[model samples]
Each structure stands twice: as C-alpha cells, then as structure tokens.
Target chain A: MWQPSIAPDAVDRIACVGAGVIGGGWVAHFLARGHRVTAWDPAPDAEDRLRRLVDAAWPALEALGLADGAARDRLTVVGTLEEAVADAEFVQESAPEDLALKSDLLARVDAAAPAGVVIGSSTSGYRMTDMQRAAAHPERLVVGHPFNPPYLVPLVEVAGGESTHPAAVAWAEEFYTLAGKTVIVLDREVPGFIANRLQEALWREALHMLAAGEATVAQIETAVTAGPGLRWPFHGPCSTFHLAGGEGGMAHALDHFGLENPWSRLAGPALTGDLRDTLVTGAAQVTAGRSTTDLIAERDRRLIAVLRALREAQA
Target chain B: MWQPSIAPDAVDRIACVGAGVIGGGWVAHFLARGHRVTAWDPAPDAEDRLRRLVDAAWPALEALGLADGAARDRLTVVGTLEEAVADAEFVQESAPEDLALKSDLLARVDAAAPAGVVIGSSTSGYRMTDMQRAAAHPERLVVGHPFNPPYLVPLVEVAGGESTHPAAVAWAEEFYTLAGKTVIVLDREVPGFIANRLQEALWREALHMLAAGEATVAQIETAVTAGPGLRWPFHGPCSTFHLAGGEGGMAHALDHFGLENPWSRLAGPALTGDLRDTLVTGAAQVTAGRSTTDLIAERDRRLIAVLRALREAQA
Candidate 1:
C-alpha cells in the first residue's frame, strides 16, 4: 500500500497541455493557489480563449478567497507543449478525449519534461495505462481526474496504473493537496475512476425513472435536490444509514431495508435503441428553456461564495 | 396529469398519533407552524421525550425563522389517539413501523376524527394503500413523508394511493407549502416513494464499492461530501450533466459516455448476504470512536445555524 505524502514547499510552478474547459480550469486552480502556470493548446487563438476563461474565473476564485495578486503573478501563457512543460514541477494534461492524440501528447511531454516532474492526466474515461505506454518514464504518469472547474470544487481523484511510479503518485497527491484539493487515491485502475462511476450509476437510474413514468423530469430533479441532495453534502449513503438506524447504526438499518433492495426496480436493465432516444428527449424536455451556460456560471459563483464563506469562518 | 399547486394554509389544529422521534418531529413542525397540536403516544414518558426533542429543535426552528413565542404556545399533550385527533383539521400519523399497529391506529383515528380532517402519514416505509385500507375513510389518508427533524428540513414528499381522496392530497399540499416546504407530489405510489428510492439506489452502489474494496469507507465519504456532494446541493445529476456538456446539454455528455456505461462497472451487482455484512462493518469502522448521539446533536446544531444564516440573508 502506498501512503500519500505532501511536500513542505509551496507549489510555484505548473504546466497544462490543453486550454479547453478542463485545462482552463486547471490553469485557474493553480493560479488561484499562487502557482505560475504555463499552458498550451493547438486551437487557434488559444491564448485569447484562455485569458477570457481566466477572466471569467477570476471573480469566483476571488470570492473563494483564492485568487490574489501573488497568485495572479505566477500565470504564464506559452505557445507550445514543450514550452508549457519545460521547467515545470507539475504538469496537467487536458487534451481532447482521444486515445491516440493523448498518447502522442504524452510521448512528446515525456521527452520535453524533466524525469522528476509529475504528469497528471485529466481524462475522465481513459485509464492511466493507455497514456503511460507512450511515456519514456511510465512511472511518472498518473491520473488526477478533477471535476469541472477544478478551482471551485475540492475533489481530485488520484489514480495510477501498473507502471505508474509510487513516487509519482505520492507527488501528485501532495501537489493537489497543496493546491487545496481533497485527493482520493484509487486502490487500482478502473474506468471512470470513482466519481464518474458513481455519477453514471445515479444518471442511469434517474433516466430509468424518467422513462418508466414514475416521475416527471422536473419532479425527479426537485425530489433529489430538495431532499437527499440537502443531506448528501454532510453525509454520504453509509453515514446516512448509520443515522437512520437511530441508535443501532448501519447494521440495523441494513437489516431493515436490505431485503427491499431486490424488490425495488433500481435501474432499467440497460438503455438500448429507442430507449436511448427516450432518455435524450426526457432530458431535453426537463431542461427546456434553461440555459446551461447561465446555470454553470451561477453554480460556479455560488460554489465560490460558499467555499469562501467556509474558509473565512475557519480562519 | 396533475400540476403542483401552491401549498395550503398551515393547519390551524394538528393531531399527532405517536410521539417517537419522527412523531415528536411532527409535533415540533406543526407547533412551530402555529398549529394547535395534540400529541398522544403509548410509550412511557412519551411526553417527556417529545418535549426534549422539541426543546432541542427550537434552535433549528428559530434559525429557519419559524420559531416564535406564539408558535411555541400551540402544543397540547393528550392521553390517547382519540383525544389527539378529535375535531382536528389535520392528523399526522407517525406510529412505529409496524404494519398491523399502524392499521389499528388509523382505524381508531378514522372512527374519532371529523369527516373533513386530512390524515397524513409521516412514514418512511409503509405504503399509503396499506395505511388507508384500515381507515373507514381511506380517501382522507395520504403520505406526507418528511425528512428527519421536520422542523428544519424543507422537503415534504406528498403521495397518495389509488383510494386516497384528491381533496385530501390538495389539502396536504397546501398545508405543507404554508409551513415552508418544497412539496413534491408523487403521482403514483411506490415503496420508499421518490426521495428514498433515489437515496437507496445511491446507497446500494456505495455499499457495493466498499464491499468490493474499490474504495475505503473514508475515501468513499470524502469522495462524495467533498466532491460531487459539494455541487449537488445546488445542481443535481442532470444539471451537472447539462453543465458537463459545455454548450450542449445532457444529450451531448450522454452520447460521449453512452458506450462507457456498458464497459464500466460503476457498482458491483446488488450486495449479497456476506457483502452486506462487510458493508455494515466498513461503516462502523469508518464511524468508530464517534458517539452517534453527539454527532446527531452536532449535525442538528450546525444545520440549524446554516439554515438560519441563509434565512436571515434572504430576509
């Protein structure tokens, strides 16, 4: 078992290979943490796009008490992947979700970066093995899958493949911790890692509920957000059961509800053919007239405000 | 198709059938809403227990801006269910989770309460059909499931069986809305109804992960409370997916991950006998050395404070 350890020094240097939404988030997160970030993307006008994203993210980061002059001074825009990764202690790869493109980029990064640099992939789907195979030093590659807008959210799942160096894993965990992220180390390689896997399960069941006519999309969303969603932030399922058991704990609650599991239609077998169409239609109907961009921006703003309040309270 | 209407005025008079933890919560909620509450429970010292629960709940109610001297003056202790329900506008049944006992109590309540009184069950499990079958006027019985400590939590799931009266449903909805709850009307009857159904699905998956050794108990809790749990309070799974799709919608994200669903093992198959034991053990180990009573009290205190702050800010 590999234990996680954090370095005592401040993380002042960072690099990112892509500057899309996820990559832009990585840049914002590092810059918010007072790390100088160098980023490169193949898209035309990538620097302009990245600067716009940074500007959009600034208020939220500042609201969270993270973005400041010292942190802002560390940001650097680079023209190429080599320029981005060179001399960086930590690198985050957020290239497009293509195995071939990601593998090729890892090979290039391996050649350009120093041996001690930790390369973390932001790929939500691909395993570490897929990207590490192209790297000259496979041990240095790890997956540091972060939720969207890495600066506002606190979870970063750190995973490693068979060839991923234990030291690299430790370094990646430490770096994220110093970046003010709560890191979870994956015991082994798994697709979607941890968060997405749990989310997919929830989405699958939610779609099934919509399809079966049990509840409308609006009611379902309202039920979750107003109910379980309220408590989930403070307690996960298991702790919920512990509390539900009254004085007995999870064992009692499980014994009481355990038998009901098989009887309840949890998830539809699987989505096939037209069932997929039904899901899309249901989702569209539910979210009709709602602006995704507006919602994201609103959610990000609220998150930063809440986190900022909590941080201030702690201080 | 039923459209969700505005909640009715707070019940002027409430009759509580049992005074356990859940029953006591009902007393606190109704009383805090300025209803004259008549509470009855066979358990020895039930009144004392109910009083302690209410005293503890006062801070939470005050935080929600619902606790006032006038609101607190409306509570009345009674010797029997008959006395409690007599001439009441709304009767909230929160008896122990025994089907036969609930049926017997509802039967007696039907005999005693006025014909126009709406009877709501604060049950987390029993189906409305079963509870109503024992009532002389089954049409008056409806499910009004509230989360723990009804005085603080704002969610109230209003569901009715086939035999339940439409008028009763409307009345229950109105009453809950007046008391400041986000009411979700379930069109069809289902075990655990909507909120618990979603919760159970998530819990089942979390247990499977713990049982499979994919993640430790602490990691799983951290993964949620610090990760998606952070955002879920404001944006649910569908909303999150909508954001994940960037400019697109859930459809875009679904198309991207549709294939991965089949390939990924999000959660192990429903937990079996021994796996159930492992899950319980893991939860206990995770919460080891912590007193649940203290935790519950602390959680209640914090929830009250947070909700109060939000309410004050809104004001």
Candidate 2:
C-alpha cells in the first residue's frame, strides 16, 4: 500500500483526463496556479478545443492574479491517458457522465498512474463510492466536484467513497485549499452533493413555474437575479434566515418559521428536537463568535459592496 | 368603480401599513424614491423601530443615489390604518402573514383610501385572490410582494386575484418600475409567487441535507457564496443552464441534462413538447438579441467585475 509522501500543497505535476469543458477548466486553473499540467482526452479535436478554452479563460485568471511561473506553455496535451498520468503526482478525471465508461476509465487510470497518487473524479451527480467500485486502489479515489468555470469559482466539494481511506479525503481537501480553492469536505457521499442539490431544487421549481404558466422566463429570471440572488453571494439560505430571526438567530428562525410551509413542492425535514438541535448547534459553530447584531451588520456591509459592484459591472 | 388616473410613475403620496421588517423596508424604499409616505402600525414601539430601520438603510440608499427631493423627513407616522391611507394615492400593506389580519386590514384600507387608489400587499405567501375577498374595492387590490430589505433588493412580484383588475396589476408593475424596482408581473397568482417558491425549494433541500448529516452548515454556506451563488446574480437558473448547453442553448441543455436527474429532493415537471417549447422560447426571449457566444462573453465580463468587487469589499 502506498502512503502520501509529497506535501499536499506542493504537488507540481498534475494530470487531467477527459479534456472537455470541465477538464479544460481544470487545466486553466492549474496553469494559472503555476503548476505543470499533463492533459489527455479522446475527442478528435480535444487539443485545439482545450487550448481555446484555456486562452478564453486566461484573461479572467490574470485579473484574479496568477502565481509565479504561471504560463500557458506549462500545459502538455498528450495523445494517450497512460502517458498523461505516467509522471503525474495528482490526477483529476472530468469524463462524460456515463457510469460504465467512468468505471472502466477510472480503473484504467488507477492501473496506469503512480501507486498511491490520489485521483479525484469531477462527476457532478455520481457518488465516488459507486465510481470507485472497479478501481484497484480505491483507497485513494475521492470525489472533488467543482462548479462550472472551475478556473473562477472557488468551491470544490471533496468527499471519499465507502472504499476510500479517511486520510485520502483529508489529503484532497488540503491539496485543493493549497491550489487557491475553497474546499468543503463532506461527511459522506450524497447525490449531487450540496451546491448542485440546492441548485437543482431551485432549477426544478423554476421549470415547474414555467410549465404551470404562473411566470414567464424573464419574470423568473428577474425574480432571482434582482432579489435573493443579490444577497446570496455574502450569505447562504441558512445564514440569511438566521439573520431574519432578529436577535435569536437560527433557533429563533426555526421556531418562528417552522420547517413546514406550503410554499414549496419539496418537503422539508421534520423539525424534530434532534434535527433542531443539530441545526442550532451547527449554526452556532458557523457564526464563529459573532453576535447576531455583528453578523447582520457584516451582512449589510457586504451586501452594499456587492450591490455597488453589480452596478459598476453593469455600467 | 375606481380607475387609475394618475400617471403610475409620478404617484407622490403612498401609504404603508404594518411596520416590521418588510413594512419598514417599504417605508425606507418609498422615502428614498422621494415619495411622501404615511405609515401606520399597531405595535407599541413601531415608530422607534421604523425610524431606526430607515436610518440604517439611508447610507446604502445614498450610495445608490437617491431620487430628487428625497428626504427621511417626508415620512409621517399615523395613529390608525384608516388615517394612513385616507389621502394616499397608492397603498402598500405589509401586515403580519395571518390570513384574517391581512383580509381585515385590506378591507379597512380599501374602505379608507381615496377612490381610484391601488392597494398592494407585501405578503410573501397567501394569494391576492384569497385576501381580496374582504376588500370593498377588490378590483383595485393587487399583490406587489417585495423581498426582504425591500430598499436594497430591487425585485417586486406583482400578480392579481380573480377580483383584481388587470389594469391595477399593470399599474402596480409600472409604479414599481418607476420607483426603481425590477418588476416581474405574473400571468397568474401561484402560492408564494416566483422567487420565494424558488428560495423555499433551495432552503428546504438545505434543511434536508442538514437533517440527514450529508453536509454541515458551514459547507452549505460556502457551497453557495463561493460556488453557484456567484453566478446567480447575473444569470438565473434557466439562463445559466442554457449557457451550459454550449452552442445549443436551453433546448440542448434540456435534451442533455433531462429533468429526471436524481440530484434534487423535488420532482421536476415532465418535459412535454409544450413545456419544452415554453422553456426554449422563454430562454430565447430573455436572451433577447444576443447569441450564446455573446451571452457567455457578457457573463464572464460581469463575473470578473463582480469577483474583483467582492474581493475589494472584503479588503
């Protein structure tokens, strides 16, 4: 069994498989972070498309600031997946979302890559556990899902599969943090994970409204970007409601709003004592020693900044 | 029978009933728009709270640029709901969410406000049709629900009940737009309107995740602010996915990522030929004259500005 030897933060050589939009995005992100990347894809025009994507993303990454030695020349597009991972210290798979293809590809990558080098699959909806079922070194396989335009968005949710070691999850989380990414390591594998699930819920509801003719497309669009979407960049649904509870925070909100409402087609969890306590405690932890007053003030300050930024952008 | 005679954009005298967060927010909004506002609330300390809320919101409004003649002193707190609306040209009721309270209050406002004045309720849920049953001038009653912190967030969803005149709904939409709001007038009233239903769906899925131990509160927060939330301010769910469809836009996205994904807690509407056409056409309408390429460029440009602004604000 192989153990992690390189410092999680300092891994220099990375391999990216299945160079479509997501894989190309990962390539752009790594290149900007000043890492040497070896990328592989099966598409006939994968190299040309990947380079175009990287070039398109370059300006934004430069605006966000690039690290020392960051350059597009550092990326090497190889013809074969084995050659791509042969000398790689870390590997990321962003293959098409087909189960049989993913399983077979992951197994092949596992067989080809250096033993114990952690591999992450960027499957938006599949569980890492299921994908790793065919891998020989499943212990090092983890899910490191990212949002669209991975070169810009900072969130990467890391989670280990049932067959994976806890240490691999921790290693992946630290590595992503070192790569100028914000990491959220989950307790277990959940379908679609956190952000996507929330997004899908909202998207599904929007479709339902459109189908019902309750709202038009422009109206639904306005309903979001002009309203709650403005506030969400600084605060999430949970934290926003916590502020809404006035002095009481989440506990107060739960008591006042309750979990039951006729507003959504999605059924919320029962506000059982155990669940309530979990939420209250979780909220208290995230509040991080700030008073509700302080949180609200911070929210307002950030909100003002965001609104001003949006206006400036529009201009 | 009352008819809207004043130019909807130039209505100067407005009445606000109920003086909590939502109501107080409306007061702050109308004041910044340079309208003379009369307010009424039954709470003992309503005046003090309302003043404090407005004062807190003033600086942000100033930053956004106040309308001509705007001043906090233009607001007047009154002794009764009847006194509040008697001389007002437009009435906005932000009462407690109790059906009976809202019904009775609308009836009282309808009876007291001058003929031809339109009344808008700030109820987050509860259809206007249900609330209008008690109003004498039900034809003039329309639901003009604003999101929290109405002074800052610029979305107001306008829809009418069975008893409400289409003219009143149009008047409310025009009035809100003139008052510096982004308005989305619904074709029909649905429970919770559009934005809240979408918000509630996301919120409910979040709570479900928390209860199931699939994610932590901190994870949920980070998942939003750092990931999808950043994109949402510029693109709604439909438009975002439409872009994700690459050159094919919404039609392609619908075909590629069908609504049957097991990712969300809620079930989506079936993609019937009609529903599919509704979404495709809606996406086309919102896309306006821009091609997918142009929209993508715009999104990236705005995103860069937004990210930079957020970073500067944090600094």
Candidate 3:
C-alpha cells in the first residue's frame, strides 16, 4: 500500500513553463481539471498564442465535461520562468527539445520552486536521466511526457531520472492520475517511451510503402483508421493477440505464428526527397483544402464523440 | 467508370466455408446484411459452435441496426462445401491458416462454384498467389482479408495474386464496399498485407518488452488502448504525426524529428518461455477471472458502440 505523501492541495496550483502548443496544451488540461495555472514563455507573442490555443481547445474539453468551477479565467499568463514557478506546488516544463536549454530551465525552476515540489518535463524524446543532469534537486524531477492536444488525449508518460527519488516519481504519477490523465510510469527509461516507439515504427513502415509506391498516403491512412486502429483503443497488441489466439489464447497465438513475425527484418525506410514531398503533398490532399483551424475543430469533435462512445460502451 | 458488373440480387446470396469464429462471423455479418447465408465445415461440432458464435454476436450487430429482413433464421448450415457454394454468387473462405488446407479447399471451391464469381480468402498471413495457385480459375481468386470477428471490424484488405484478374479484384473491392466495408485494394501483394504487418511489428515489440521484463502484459495493453489507441480509430499513424507537428503539419513534423525516430533500432526481441508465460498470466490477471465468453461479449458490445460512434461522427 504505497501512497504519495504530498498534500492534495499541492496539485491545485500548476505552473506551465514554455508556452508553445505542448505547453499551452498542458495549461488547457490543468485548467480544465480545475487547477489554477501560471504559464510563462520567452516568445514575444507566446501569451497571445497560448490564449488562442486554449480558447480553441476549451470547447472540446468542456464537451467532455470539465471539472466543477473550471474556467479559462483560472489561467494567468506570467512574464518570466521564475515568476511563473515561484509559488508552484508542481512545475511542468514543456520547453523546446534542446538538452542544454532544458537543463538550464529545469535547474532554474528547481531553484525557485518550494522544496520537495516535483517538476515534470513534457519531453517526448529525452530521458529524465539526460535532462535532469543540471538540476540542483534532480531527485524531485520527473518526465511527464504528454501527447499532442493533451486535453483531448489522456496519456501522460511519467518516468524519473537515474537520480530521481522514487517518491517524487510516485508523487508525479499520482498527480497525473488525479489530473485525469492515463499514467504509464516506466520503471526505467526506454527510448521513445511506449506509444511514440510503436507509432514511429508504423510510420517508418508507411514511409517504406510510400517510397516503393506500394500504397498512397491516403491508402496508408485508410489501412489504419479503418482496420486495426478500430480495435486498438480497446485492446493493445498483446491482449489483442491473446484474443486472436482463438480459444487457445496468447500462448497459442505466439506458438502458431508469433515466432514467425518478421520484426527483425522490419526497419525504417530511408526518408528520401521524393518520399518527403509525397508525404507533404499527400497530407495536404487528405485535408481537402481544409484550414488547420477547421481540421482541429473537426478532430476535436470526433474525439469528443469517441470519448463519449467509449464511456457509454463501458457503462 | 469501374463497376463490379454484379446485380444487387447477385450479392444477396453468400456462401461461407470454414465454420470457425472468423467463418461464423462472416455468416453473421452476411445474415445481418439481409443476405441468405449457407455455411459448411468439416468439423463434427462446427455447426453447433458456429451457431453459438452467431448467437453471441447477433445482439451486438442488432444494436448496430441490422439490415432490412435480417434475422438469425436466414443462416443455414450445410454438410458439404460444394452444396454451400452451389448457388452462392459470392463465396468467402475463412478456413484455418494452413497453406495446404486453404489451397486444396479453395481449388475445390473454384471447381464447383460458378465461373467469374469471386471467391475471397480470409487468411491473415498467406498471400493470394500461394492460396490460388491450385485453383483452376485463379483469375477469380482474390484475398478479401478481414480482421477478427469479420462482422464488426470494417476494414477488408482486398488484394489479388499474380494470376488473379484485375477485374475480379475490382469486383471484390466494389462488392465489399457495397457490403458496407472500408476497402483498400492493393496494386501489389504485401507480406501480411497492410494492417497485420503493422500489428505484428507492434506485437513483436511487446514480446520483446515482456521477454526483457520491461513491463507486464497489462502495462503493454494499457500503454496502447489508453494512449495512442485513442486517436487511431480516426487517424492513422501518419495523420496522427501530422497533427503532432502542431502548426507545421506533416512537413514540420518530418523536418523536426521524424528522421530521429528510433524505428531502425526496434527489432523484436526473441520470444522465450518466460515471456510467453508472462503474457498468458498477465492477460488472465487483466481479465480478473472473467471467462473468454465474458471477454468476447464485452468486446462485441464495445465494438458495436464504436461502430455506432464512427457512423454518427461521419454523419
């Protein structure tokens, strides 16, 4: 029976550093969860951009049912990193992927934030071990990697660095869970964590098919959304295989053909110029001349419906 | 304009050979679509099992709104394969994945069935060429590969072998589309086709993680359904990445870090005894003492809800 010792009030005030899309998304999500969010970004126009991003995303979160008393007014866009995190009980860093910048920024946050308050990084690539090096209180640093439009997608991959205290990791994990995100707390760092790794592998294969003209970008997209993608939201590869094993279960699925999987032979195809152009042009075509704002609105609508559908089905 | 050249009445009579889960599911779908279905299987208790499977699946499809005149009474179980295909304008073979068995049975079906009537195999792995090589009218042989529980999952990977006629492939593609499926007709044969190749690669990675004791089976499953799986039903890997690129879209996504994806290094780890047992046990734990019947029922219910959700979203 392990438990996080932090007061529940600690998570009520969240500071979001780096006000780009990911950082702004974190602001949206934390704000929707009824937290008071203080955000900071160095960009001259980041405040305006963050506000717009949140305003665009709020309807979807609201449709999904926001927490009581949640409002856009709960967010305060501050000027500097030190000002934003000075009183933050928990800090979330979504700065760019530059290692040196993250190290310096995280160290700065650590210096200003209260003692024992955990800081989480929204890096999809860097391991906490690498990113936590410059922090004076590396023990309280954890990686809380999030998906795009974090308000819509629930996953938040939480992992700690080599020197990160187990308690800090646990505290962050519990906080994320409480924040309404699905938390996958890794025991050790694996490159790309979980979802991105699986996603990248599939993306690479699609690139191969496109390179060889085996399938078009539209066809490749269709191959997924209409196929296995339908089942994945409810089941993963392993358990799905378990069911695929028929009555014999996963052991039988593996025994029959699992060993025969050509994983070793499957590698990322080279990203050539033609392939790059194909992807860019094909994606544009897939949009059918829809603006990014239109696409975002459409996606949010569909995602909200999907989330509602799953909830009803589970019920 | 391309056409299947089959009358509406022609597709109303369907022959389903191989009465296992997949075969039975095809029967259920055809029946629910208001088609008269004749099914045959060599197994002694296959009819009983097939009936049970259909009965178990009917409620879900019914909830999804069955076609006009759809009923369980429309399904007829026959004793011989020839009888099943004697009057069938379209034949679907969902037999086991044994190459020899499929080849022999498909040849026999081609010999008996009406000439020019397309016969589709539901093999998850075998290419159409290998399966149709034994058929005399291999021109009409095509692969209409479907995901498990063909009654539910909408994707039907339609492909043709070397000797298979382009016309037959086109007809099957149109026929499946008419039957209310999302179709991806391949210009060339791909090993494991499109979706399975992606699925198997991810499966192998899970096997690697399990073998390495990196995560439990439940964690692997949760890592998916709760994470990327949430977006997959509408967006494929490429489209998802395009959205991940923020305002930059696909070009920015690729330029920023697509090449940095560690797909080249993600070969599947070897499947070992410990890993196998861990998967089996972890799946059992995830089920929490629920029987396979319970699991299947839950899956069908959810799938029906998902289908309804997608249909509504598109509408």
On DockQ, the leading prediction is 2
C-alpha positional error of residue A275 in candidate 1 after TM-score superposition, expressed in Å:
35
Q: Lowest summed lDDT over 10 consecutive residues: which window, candidate 2 chain A?
A: A292-301
Rank the candidate models, highest lDDT first: 2, 3, 1
Compose the digit string of candidate 1's lDDT tens values, residues A70-146.
46556788778899888877789998788898989988997898767778999886788877887777888899989
State the DockQ of every prediction. 0.18, 0.79, 0.23
Tens digits of lDDT, candidate 3, B86-134: 9888999998888899999999999998885889999886888888888
- So what's the TM-score on candidate 1? 0.80
Q: Please, what is the TM-score per model?
A: 0.80, 0.97, 0.83
Q: How would you encode candidate 3's per-residue C-alpha lDDT over A123-195 as one tens digit per residue? A: 8868889888887878989999997667766788888889888888888888888888889998868867777
DockQ of 2: 0.79
Give per-residue CA lDDT, model 2, range A180-216, as digits (tens). 8899998878889999999999999988888888788
Model-by-model lDDT, in order? Answer: 0.67, 0.88, 0.74
Per-candidate clashes, comma-separated: 4, 0, 0
The residue pairs found clashing in candidate 3 are: none
Segments of candidate 1 deviating more than 4 angstroms = A1-10, A67-73, A259-315, B1-10, B67-73, B98-100, B262-315
RMSD of 3: 13.1
Give the candidate order by descending TM-score: 2, 3, 1
